[model samples]
Target chain A: MNIPLLSLKSILSRPLSTLLSWLLMSFGVTIVVLILLVSAQLKNEISKNAQGIDLVVGAKGSPLQLILCNIFHVDFPTGNISLKEANNLSRNRYIESAIPMSLGDSYRGYRIVGTTKAYGDLYGAEIQSGQWFEEDMKAVVGANVANLLGLNLGSQFQSQHGMSEEGEEHEEQSIIVAGILAPSSTILDDLILVSIPSIWNVHEHEEEPGEHEGEIIDLPKLGIAVSQEQLEEEEITSILIKYRSPMAAVMLPRMVNEVGNFQAASPAYETARLFNIIGVGVDVVNIIGILIVVISAISVFIALLHSLKDRKYDIAIMRSMGATRRQIFVHVLMEGLLIAILGCISGLVLAHAAIGILAFYLEKLNLSWSFFVNDEVWVLTGGLIIGMLAAIIPAGLAYKTDISKTLSKA
Target chain B: MIQIAGLSHCFSDNVVISYPDWQVADGEHSLILGASGSGKTTLLHLMSGLLKPTNGSVIFDTQEINQLSPSRMDKFRGAHVGLIFQKPHLIAALTVKENIKLSTFLGKKPEHNRHIEEMLDSLGLIELAHRKVHQLSQGQAQRVAIARALINHPKFVFGDEPTASLDDESCMKVVELLKRQSDQHGATLVIATHDQRVKNHFSNKLEL
Candidate 1:
């Protein structure tokens, strides 16, 4: 008891050494904390955005890319599926909801996703003010779109050809901001949402009206519209199905994927695959963490061995006062353990502060990452283990030191 | 009370000292006299239970310390053996009083503030009680170690070349101080030294 207390005081006296070990240990721990924060946030964002939708049926290109573009709001869709195929899928009894999405327009690099009221309802997204789009070329802005573009409920803007920085398009069709959505803390907060008919009408006027031959004749019947008189089917980009029974879970998706031109994807499967992909990187982080801990242990061992020369007389005196070799051993090891604890605490605090600073950027990317996530308890636990593990080598050295030889050398 | 029989020690397989028998009675003031390699320090280390004898036994009262496990011996030593080293081994990070309090904490005893204050008062160290050990002069730090050694009220006290680093005048004063305190506490006192300045102070002498 006296020896451990004495050893603690000795460490506190040597401020520079204590601080050096603390900083070194913190360096390794901070990286581990940062990786967990970023990965978990990205995973959470993808899963949250994938909610409510059961299937994403797109053109026979990259199903992952189409899902990314339409649902997760990243990259370009591989291609579009036919309207007839979309309509036939909606006719299935297992399909509870269908939301058509048309892309290929932007307002100042922010995407303009031409969708319907059903799109908002699928996710239970609400309008902050005004109403959903009831007219063609009308739009409802996301929270970020409203904030970044400074668009009010009645404000009007023009659409661009793509989300590129080239500034190539001059042709503009006026788009009125009919409604704005409350922030969902998801991908919904960043897009310019509008009715699907608005996108169809934009291509209708792509040419100079007088120079185009019979443009008027093709225009009226050009786009597919849902008829008021009930039809057995209708065309759309994708149909998100919610099964009334688990039988549909087994039967309907297989039926949709195999029997039709459209391909069905479960958001659940895609999310699982996304996690598996990210897990490879996490495995690398764990390896690096283990390596850092090993290095930290070696550092502690060397530093302690280095300090033992100066501590010889001190150990001898304690020995003379009836402290056993084992007591001296515990005393030295305790000093190392103290250094580890200091490092672990500092590392955890550093990690929390780093996440707090990056929160804004994370939000901008529509990825919600909290510094104090559920797994942080494990991170702290792991960091402490690393710190203690690092101390063991030093402790072992201290244990093996020959007290008589050491005192004689002095 | 203490007893040593056929105690011997070696460093790097080289014999440093071998003694056939030695003993000090309770409340005796004994001085061990020797040249550089005479094993006076080795005798003190064995007597205080800091070093295990390569041969024979060191009995403090009835306990043969060579047989006690290192950790158990540390507890026994902390509780009953008070040691003052040649150079003060006071922890540099702690204030004077905190260093003294560490003994109590390690010994698992409630703080005896009255005894500490009395020790400090007798040694004229009360005013320096809050100063860091690093801030103390050699003489002042030596006096602090003396105070720390006596604070535990041990039955025996060991001083290893305690005055070797001090000036003549300070060395004489330190010896007088240690002798008077040992007498006041009725504790056996052993001084292992070649200083010769403390020769006349101890009534009982062991020549090596």
Candidate 2:
């Protein structure tokens, strides 16, 4: 006579109500859990790629868009800036090291970056093949680029004129894959690295010193004056700056933005702003999840209350068979708890299943998604609390049931 | 053996039942006869410790049932008493054998299938032991309820309108079965009902 087993059997005897309650409970849990999963993955990917660089100096535009474009590589560059002005700013006493990156052409949607060897050092990217790009037109492909594009050492590929795959290809210069970097499991694993001259000669990622977006009116003649050689030393897409100390964080972005046509964006500040925007959407989802849980609790409460009426005679019979009021109370509570636990399990599986689908899309970007994070544990705790809370009043009713009255009624 | 003294029960100042004192020796079988609302069921609840009398004491053997706490009373009842209601309230999801074994389970006694098998065989419900309670006919389900009551081999058995809804033949068979089973186990039996057909089955009868 396992009393709990008997209670569970009683619950199972009414399959429709149990299933309805369980499904509702899982719906609440699944929404909360899926939100946690997606947010956790996004945070991890953002912070991992945003580390090391404190501020990004780029063509004047939206600061968040600048960080999104240069630091995270998720958007396009905001035109271009003079390399001379960016370098002079990099020489500030508060600056630790500045790495210049120019992005324009791509190979099959993977951005081909032209930067110094210091850029590789910033991400700790190790060369797994011949060597890092040593000369113009010599390129080092990241592991994902190598795997996805099947680029091997000595393989040569033509670059497209812009960030997108549909952008016209620069067929004149076929850049050779001088090296392939090992997988760093970061945004670095999705890029193609080459010398700065390679990007200029290929698609002219530069612009006149004061030209921001107005050059679009003279697109056909934009690259005529800056010879291939002059373009190399004249412009770069953006300069990634790291502060020597925390105090520099307060003054550097302010000074850089005040001085040049380039706007400075802190990855930390911008990413947080991005998440704040994303947070609003997530807050709405959280409310919906909580509403689902609240409705399910009401459902459980009503279901249990009705079942109590239905089981009054049965409860009286159990009392006659030696069950205490406390036993009966625990029996009812256990029924609610069982439904909650089942919901938690099903919701977790559902959350991970949704994440599994997200992972397929993220994989193309060389990003990783994982489950079983701290957020999931919090969601599990939430589920149990809801279950226990839902059962309280119903269990109390069972506790106060008058056995004799119920038997006589039957 | 059971003894009741100075028994009275009230319902919110609306109705009160003042029961006549009665004493029954061990192994005795008795019937409580009454009209509707005559308090036959109330007296039985008091005797079985299911209800606390407004002003009275019930002594079953050496235990003061009314004086015991609810938990202790439940334990005492599971070990020493059995009850059958007007309708069989056996859990519909469980099999006949599982329903009967619930008595031993609630008593916290290590389950013994032998006791269940004996009760089923004696009640001629062995063939239906594995069937869900919902599949049983009214008489068969009633017999299973009886088997559950006897699984603990209780010293006392109480029934409230156990055969009120049955036909004449089925009612007699149920009474005879209860009588024969109680005789074989040397247990006392008390039944409260409004059914006139069950009147002749008990020689020791209380009429209200």
Candidate 3:
């Protein structure tokens, strides 16, 4: 009938080759799209969670580990730093604000971070229900922590000693969920927030059983105003610092590393370094995906050229039936274009479905990716260009078919 | 009516075939008789505007087709002429009815499913309308080709050895169908074949 319908029938006439070209194209597109989604989301997650914090000053260890532990919460803490030394560094004029976090305990694999109200402010966190923790043992749960662990207001759970579920539970120090934070699309959504004293009290009960029995020392809330004696004896994990001025960016990290027993790491510098280290593997895989797409284009070219040999007489017959050279040319080109359009659309669908499944399994990372992106339009356009390139020569050959000679051969 | 004057085609420097002047009135059935290598197919191709002659003009009702551009010639031939070859060159991917429908599609004629069905009915192919072309016998495929050629109701029907490979009974049957279909559609029938079995059917002849 019409050229498009005729082109479709011609493509269907040879099933195996068409399938091969289609599968290769879709496979290549899937790989390319998946990589784009993951890398973009990874960069977004890293930067968003690390916003506002100028430096992470923790125990003497790998600066990257210090950042990973205190900022991103994906790695183990280097060790603990004395509260006296950390408080002294917080008093430095270059530091605008400092939030002290004491991390070591968990409840059902979600880390229970102990800090003041400023930690919630750092991420623009808002309470979704109930209220913020007001007492030492009262806890505020992140949106993800609340949903995943089914924690609601007044839900009581004891702290575990370590970050994993197998850690020893401190039954005597039960923590009650005081409130739940709204989803902020940051690392805050994956944590449980408690006061610093809650973590210290849980450990102090085990370390010195009856010595600090009824002496519930409520330290001042705003500036971490512990007595000199208490500050000397207590230890905390890390302090997240914001710079007072741009000059602090150059002068502060050096001051902490040289003057105090601490390692200060810049979140911006470390994440870029991390991406550079991961980029080599990403580039290699991206190259392979592009190579597969190019090969599929070649496969399409060869298939069309090969089929043209058998269909020469058929094309001649169409010409005899009054098909113009241009019509014949467009008919052949439409086949290739059809294959590309089909392959690109299916590839995008396959890629999105795969990412959805991956995001489901890796939900603990709190990663979110979109189903459609602007870069995929380029992928579609590239596919169509390749399709046209592959079909042009074959279509031109069909256009030049000598009708009288071909029909006379019979 | 069709008119041809000073028709000759050149294949190469040393090979040229010239055709004598001829004219056929409207709705007349004529045969071009010749042996192998006698330019019968070439003359048929020129008359149908499939090929442009080196020195000739084919006039159909005062329209000089050879003077038309390639694109216009193709549209002209599609609108006014239908062709059949020695082998039924049906596109294998399409069914029997689809093959007939292709004529109306390419000829830029308005599609009429009823006309296609009637054509197939008269050809005794109504039952096999949905079957793929490869499944049909030689005679059956040729009949499908005839149905395709007549689908657009073209002014001229050209057959180049339409029944060359069939037995005597099938050959005569095909010739009868061609004449009958052309007559029904008010088309002039022009067939080029060396088969002696075809001579008894057509009274007008051009021999080379």
Candidate 4:
């Protein structure tokens, strides 16, 4: 109590220096913590959405784009590959399972994905209402999609021509909501799922007698349906593959890419590459945070050193009153400790404040934020240690003050 | 009783200062009279154990202060001696009352709040006790410094030109206050000063 009161008075007596030191320290800590939180959140979101899909096969294009389109469901696929060729890879001895996905439509702004019950099985999806789609034009909605679009069991909505809001609407065709999937908390939660026949039927009706007027229409033939004009060759946007063995990871992507007409991408490799690109930006932010923290520590050291020099006479007086060198040393160190603790606490609040803003924005997009990670605790401890280290030199100088010489000079 | 024998000091340049042997009886107030280069402050510091002498010892009764370890020397000084410096230095951050409290804490005594309050009341500083040191006038600050030095009521009180900068009237007042406080507490008092106004305040004079 005695030491604390003395240190508090000393700090209060020099208000401007104390405040300047604290603000700098807190700002530096906040930035460091901000970057860590963002980096952690970004890595978690990417990996969570990717799940365990081992490989993606798409029309020849950027592998990154293939993973983004097929696995993460964030970008448009590079046109489409033949369903026959995609199925051929499904039969590969090293492949455990393959799920094909066809996408070119949206209800509202969320994509309508044409997939099989296997895709739902791959994600461990459970039905919240009704049952899975059994026939053409029957759709199963994901939890978030159902909530955001207000399409419950038995609701119906028409599909748009492409996966964008401005796509031409397929007004003549509407899909019935056969079921709603429970919350998977993955990319699937944002999608409206239907079977493959629905995609073909919707597009098949798109260019019929209304536009043909008995004119010869050049339609790529699908083997299943030549009763009407043959549509374009049957295609799907991509295939998601699960490898049967750990060794398949070495050969699968290479084998699929060797097929020439199509290319293969690994979710891990593509996501790593994407993060490497983003890591450059995160690295810059990290460097800036480190510089700010270092400068804050230096400023604290300077503030303490300058005050120690100024208080020589006061130190001499304390000595005359019989203060031990150790007492004086601890007295000055207390100043540093008080400043550091206050700054650390303020920085934590600032870090949480920034996270609050980020979490709010993520929630609006139907995404959840993860907090309470181990790195945050480390930051708090490291910040306080730096504060104490900054004071060490100044405290030693106070302990070595020559009392009699200082008093005689005074 | 304070005893000194063959005490001396030297600068790195080999300029040596030698002191004549002297004894100050308990409760006796003495003044060391000297000019600017007379080493009066040096003598005061050496005898008070602020600086170890080059040759010889200062013994308060039978205990040789210079022979104590650094920490033990500080403990000894706190319990047995008090000092008033020329400039009336106090911690600028603390109130007058807190400065006295700090002194008592550093004195190595079991907590002595009652003694600090009595010192403040005796020094007429009870009203200004809560005011910060910077807010006090020079004279009030000097009184607070005195109260701090004497709060422990040591066996000896030493002043290093405590009244050199004050006007004659205030100087006399300060010297008289130092003497009266030391007498009431039964501690020996020694003032190192060239100021002529302090000459009449003490009977035993040591001319350096």
Question: Which lDDT tens digits does candidate 3 get at residues B1-208?
Answer: 9999999999956698999999888999999999989999999999998888999899998999999999998898888899999999899989998888788889999888888899899999999999988899999999999998888889999999997899999999999999999999999999999999999889889999
Please rank every candidate by TM-score, starting with the best: 3, 2, 4, 1
Q: Sorted on DockQ, highest at the top, how do the candidates line up?
A: 3, 2, 4, 1
Candidate 4 lDDT score at position A93: 88
Q: List the residue pairs that clash in candidate 4.
A: A220-A231, A220-A232
Work out the iRMS of candidate 1: 2.9
The DockQ of predicted model 1 stands at: 0.46
TM-score (0 to 1) for chain A, all models? 0.83, 0.90, 0.94, 0.87
- Candidates, ranked, lDDT: 3, 2, 4, 1
Per-residue lDDT over A31-74 for candidate 3, one digit per residue giving the tens place of the 0 to 100 score: 88888877877887898899999999989989889898898898
Model 4 segments more than 4 A misplaced: A126-168, A175-184, A200-232, A364-370, B110-115
TM-score of 1: 0.83
| Model 2 pairs whose backbones collide | A1-B105
Candidate 3 contains a number of clashing pairs equal to 0
lDDT at residue B54 of model 2 (Cα atoms): 92
- TM-score of predicted chain B versus true chain B for each candidate: 0.94, 0.97, 0.98, 0.97
Could you say which candidate leads in TM-score?
Answer: 3
Compare the candidates by DockQ and give the number of the best one: 3
Q: Spell out the clash pairs found in candidate 3.
A: none
lDDT tens per residue, model 4, A1-410: 27878988998899998998788778888888888877776677778767768888888989898888887677888888876666566778888777778888888888899888878887889999999988778999989889878998889889998777888998888899999999987777888899876887788764542232234332122112222222335688887787899999988878888875889888898889998999898889878876776777788789888987779888877877778899888888888888878887898788878788776776423323336568878877877788788888998999999877887777
Q: Model 3 reaches what TM-score against the true structure?
A: 0.95
